[model samples]
Target: MRERKAAAVRERVREFALELPGAYEDFPWNECVIKVNRKIFVFLFLGHLVAGQGDSPPTVTVKLAHPEAHAHALSAPGAVPTGYGLGRAGWVTVPLGEPGAPDAGLLCDWVEESYRTVAPKRLVARLDAERTAPPGA
Candidate 1:
């Protein structure tokens, strides 16, 4: 049952990642790197959330410019302090427990916020223009 649940989580996360606008590269150590117009906007890492593991399934950790979003995520259920030096920074980690608990939309919101937070103002403007422009126009 645990294996099945983990597989489901992996599939869901992968699909959600692919749905993000712009191309991405799946990096080593279970990291997802998204590039918009050849610029990196988001990088996601999946690490062991539970102890006693050999390559555990990914729990989402997003990078933020400031600490507000990180604080908010920490307040949410299933979200916890990221260990191994990341928590010391402003990274908040969210676990993949009951899928119903933290739905994909909410996770995607965090990803979107992280992208906006890290991306430069000029790059963000370009991305925003691309987003608002008519498809293929």
Candidate 2:
């Protein structure tokens, strides 16, 4: 049912985040968290694991740089400002299972942006180089 579908979505998003350079997952508080350079960039939560958060499962809480991007992301369905004073810093909770949740592409984009915001400058440079470098060189 919905739980199965949501689990699939979690796996796909996990794969996408781990594909980024230096990204890895950790089980802090038993919740799946993706990190880059030892800094948490993405958090995946389901069920009451995110208790009191009021957000649905298959949710990704990410950090954003610009207010415009934060505002734009909040405009999407099932998207909400992250709680615990995090929203002031452009963090948002985006539900992947909602009827109008952002597509895979946009979510990945948000993940990338969050990574860029938190990762060390050297690591970010490495990521950019990989993207700009010609194939096989």
Maximum-TM-score candidate: 2
Tell me the lDDT of model 2 at 44. Answer: 89
Which pairs of residues collide in candidate 1?
none
Q: Write the per-residue lDDT of candidate 1 for residues 1-137, one digit (tens) a residue.
A: 64466446655655665555554655645556565555544444454434554565556666555677677778766666666776676667666554444555676777767666665667567668877999899
Can you write out model 2's per-residue Cα lDDT over 1-137, one digit (the tens) per residue?
Answer: 76676677777778899998899999988889999988899888775655565655678888988777788789887687888788888889877666676767777788899999999998899999999999999
Model 2: residues >4 Å from true position, as ranges? 52-55
Q: Candidate 1 — which residues are off by over 4 angstroms?
A: 1-23, 30-57, 66-68, 134-136
Output the number of the lDDT-best candidate.
2
lDDT of each: 0.61, 0.82
Query: How does each model score on TM-score?
Result: 0.63, 0.88
